[model samples]
Target: MASSLTKGSAATGEKTFLGHPSGLAFLFMTEMWERYSFYGMRALLVLYLAANVADGGLGMNDATAVAIYSVYNAMVYLLALPGGWLGDRVWGARKAVAVAGVVIMAGHFLLAVPSTASFFVGLALIAAGSGVLKANISTMVGQLYRDKNDPRRDGGFTIFYMGINLGAFAAPLTIGWVGQELDWHIGFAMAGAGMALGLLFYFIGFRHLNPVSSRVPDPLSAAEKSAVVRKGLVWLCVAAAAYALIGLAGVFTINYALWPLTVLGLVLPAWSLLRIKRDRDLEPVEQSRMSAYVWFFIAAAIFWAIYDQTGSTLSLFAKGHTESMLFGFGFPESWFQSLNPLFVMALAPLFAWLWVALAHRSKEPSTVAKFSFALVMVGLSFGIMMIAQGAAAGGKVTPMWLVSVYFIQTVGELCLSPVGLSMTTKLAPKKYGSQMMGVFFLAVTAGDSTIALLQLCGVPTDTQSWFASQGALAALAGIAVYLYRKKVKLLMRGIH
Candidate 1:
């Protein structure tokens, strides 16, 4: 690890913001604006796709729109592995992040062009840009902290996370409303402008950033670098050829655009596990820890499958079955998308305090137990929606029900997300650190790819029954993990 603090700087004891480095402020603002662009565009995607052609949308059906949404989101996570690698091996974090901002802005501009071709192209560009940007920015934040064991690390991260929620909370209310009330292209243009502002902020505060942000932690030897470049070019050519062949076969449709991502999502985790299991260099304890991590990955995938409906199935419910009117003024359904992040901003501090209080009492839940709790909470959130479905007045329920669902789900998120990241860092063998983080994200990719596949297969679309089924599965998974928590904890070799 590289520390950029001056000899007498905060790493040596001088206090900055909340006793941390000043660079955190710049990172926080940059991420806040990046997320503003990201969530702003995401909030409008499905709605824009499924709207009537006369209403400035592509006139896609719900299933098709949901399929696209799942694939695109999956790709965002799925590509992070390579994105992180590129940052480590080719471009350092600072330059990679800068290029990502430019690419993302270009994507939004492409969306502003009103055509089906442009829409898909824009989604592709945005997904690729986000893949490059998302993981690197978080890595840079870690680089800002000089001490690995810094007590303030958690608090600083909590503040950074709040910046994420702030952007997410504001995006839907702003860009979402503009897209719904004005023009879809206008909303996309706004997202582009948000990225521009983020880039501007980053450049203005560039001087505060540490030299660590521009360091390549793991540089390749000349021979290895040459081989890697050659392999990359080969794979690029192969992928292009495969796509061309698929299109020529007349089977390439928008609905199947996710197939490539889906295949990779399914295959990558299995490959990672196989590599881990076969690594003779790993000690027995390390192997056991990796085995336990596999279970956590499964549990996370299940949780995400149910939790991610907020962008797909739940969004559809908000459009068709949730009352959007408040005090006689109707609002865009996308405004409801803000509820999750809004609740996060409100509730995260309380959850943080709760965890600390529990820790002080020697009653903090085991990592596996926390994962189980998250699963159950998310399951129960869906159960609430199922019950709300039963109480619908004339087939439409008040938006408070959705609000309640998001609130509970946010609690689940706070429990799982931070813990998952911490666990990955703590349990991964040093040699496999980056690959282990990639595996963690693969869980998200698996969940999203599964959802996309389900949509493509024309799964039964009854909202109530669907929610009920997902809740039941999630609850059962939680119970199973809870039952085996003690066994799993042993495999963790003292890690919490």
Candidate 2:
């Protein structure tokens, strides 16, 4: 650990970029373009699937398209477990990120080809590639800052996060317009080009990166590697056999295909918690911290389940139930997807300043309290949507209603998302730090999988009922968390 710390510190004295390390700038740009490709594709996916075949779409039903969307998103999260392990143990973060970029670009290109087979194939590739890239890239950012106590760490991360939002904010307006009004395949091609540009920048800036990213932090012994390979082959064979059986039974629908992933979503967190609990090497304090994180995990899952609907259910609502014309010019439904990230970019600085101001005055809310507030805010957004349903003009509400929903949800995201990341890092046992991060992402997987299953069960067919139920549940969950805050704080063992 000390040696790792020493390696991290090596880059500290190097020249700064925008008052931070230069490597961060490279990472920031790389992640920005990657997110551009990702959110661009995301903004189009459901709309493309549900649109009529005559309109250059697959003509899938809303339920099917949404289920596929959920499963794809869920897989992207689930595969991060192996993805991060591969980076740490086999390929190193640098090589893993590079390979992921290539794979993701290929996925986007495949989507640009305009065949049903290519559509599923493209989505599979994107999910797999994003899994490999997402966790490891962030890990590389941490490697750039050697001092754990560096006051600049939080601000650096804020800057990096803004890059993510920048990409997200731009992709929807550009790619969304192209896909909705021009050509769907052309939009996918643009996404591929965006990733290609990101890769080009990565190659150009590779030399400036910290050396730690270029080598595996933990390499397995040759014997252990051999054993892992043998086990992997066994699992592969088992999966193949199961897939064959499912195909033979003629039950290979989107919902059925996602059943195994949904099961894994439920099982993975349990397995992670059990492993943490049974680890004899962990100190009692470490065990207690892990226990506290469990509550956070659950809360975060609920929050994301509501927040992530912006790309799926909300996108659909904007398309069908919202009036898109402003000043007699109709805009693309996908354009509405940009609202959250745009709001995020605009509001994040104010929220950061507010937190610091409150802290200075010794009046800041506890982390758990902030999470509760996030839930309530998200619930209120849904409640507003429920009201909007009744207030629709000629079966279509104004786009501002959904825009307002995104704005409120962005506030909730500001409270929960960064705080959750900070809490995970603080509460994680040193030995299991990376795995704990993987578990945190599983919270997202849980939420995506849960919502997907609900959609499959026709829960979202009645938008009014769906919004009302989600709003009520989220609000109630917030109150429950607030009530239980004292117990959670005790379990936190002094971690604020």
Candidate 3:
């Protein structure tokens, strides 16, 4: 009966697009352009920082550039928790997304200014604004369905996912070209322009969105709102005090501050888990499922730590170690960033079909097993890179070497990327459902910070040793998870 109601709700005389709510079309387009601005700026950041001072770049060494990128990248995901909180309790998702887009556009324009101080400020703004947009938009997509059981939910999200990649794919080719061939600031301005265009598009089509877009998911009472504000103020004071102490200790540099901030960011997830574990209302099955999720979280973090190098370490390899001439014409190495998304568009459907075919034969792998496979495959990609490193010792290796690496990693991504959050939804307790996805994104934060931490510790990612070691560790983790897959499956019970 509930399913019938869900079906009926979907059939309301409301406007539809491709059998899904009309909201998806605008949401998809907005997200695509949002990603356009994001990936556009990101593709330039490290290169700009690492380029010679004479070339209008920041002139930082490779290590500093990579560490800075890691911090900014990590924070983008880390702050999503509070972003989600504001969406759930204060502003509605619609307002949150709109306001965040404005902030993001401002950030890109700020980055276009050629001052060091403004650049850092711009990064901070983008990271915070991205958090708000990132955490709430997908939840808004779910809201469009009006019911959890709507069969269109997965298909709708899949299309939305393609939007993300579409933006990522287009940004590098366009923005990368302008940034490399012309003034870098102009490219940044172009990114801001893309976002402006996106926002205009979303506003023009705003009426198509589901009504729930303007309703906060879990609004607090007046007293509760006051309490939340007080709590936020207290946390702010604590953070300020901590910063003062670090300054007094004579270690107040950007590098030192970032590590502490990352540590604090990581603590949120641990606290979230501990809070969940203490929920006495949960049944034994829910507790068991949470335990299984912990392992999944750990494995997913490892995968992201390796996969996200496309913007940092792998990017460096592309610019310096890989030959860039194609048909004797020079091109920007940032164009390589487009490959992962291109592969996603090409292979996602193939993999989608492969999974269904396997399921028909009763041979589909459990989520846990698939996670294991992803870890191993991503690890193997790096292991292949170690071989590429050997080849580079003679001269610049072919771009195909990196292409081959990306192809392998994209395959690995297909194995785990779509599965992680979907499993989070299935496994969450009702009480924590709204916050679980936010917590799940913390895996990305943790993974990016891990790279920064390694860099700070003098473990350069460009080294053959770093590649071999991390690769082997990831593979071993995969093997251990595979060996114990049955045990984790038992905890999940009927979840898979």
Question: Please, what are the lDDT tens digits per residue for candidate 2 over residues 1-496?
Answer: 1132113334445567666766777888899999999999999999999999999999988877777788788889988999999899999999999999999999999999979889888999999999999979988887777877877787778889999999999999999999999999999999999999989988887877878898998899999999999999999999999889989998787665667776777677678778886899999998888778888888888888888888888888888888889878988999998998989888989999999999999999999999999999999999998888777635888888998999999999999988898899899999987788888888888888888888767776445788899888888888888999999999899999
Give the CA lDDT, 0 to 100, for residue 63 in model 1. Answer: 84
Error of 1 at 12 (Å): 7.4
Which residue pairs of candidate 1 clash? none
Candidate 3: pairs in clash: none
Structure candidate 2, residue pairs in collision: none
Residue-by-residue lDDT tens digits, candidate 3, 368-486: 88999999999999998898888888889888888898999999999898888779989998888878887788888888888888877777767798788878988999999999988
lDDT of each: 0.85, 0.87, 0.86
lDDT at residue 249 of model 2 (Cα atoms): 97
| Runs off by more than 4 Å, candidate 3 | 1-14, 234-252, 327-329
> Candidate 2 regions off by >4 Å?
1-15, 146-151, 248-251
Sorted by lDDT (best first), the order is: 2, 3, 1
Candidate 2 lDDT trough over 10 residues, lowest sum = 1-10
Query: How many clashes show up in model 3?
Result: 0
lDDT of 2 at 424: 91
Query: What lDDT does candidate 1 reach at residue 312?
Result: 79
CA RMSD of each candidate after superposition = 3.2, 4.0, 3.8
Q: Given candidate 1, what's the lDDT at residue 244?
A: 95
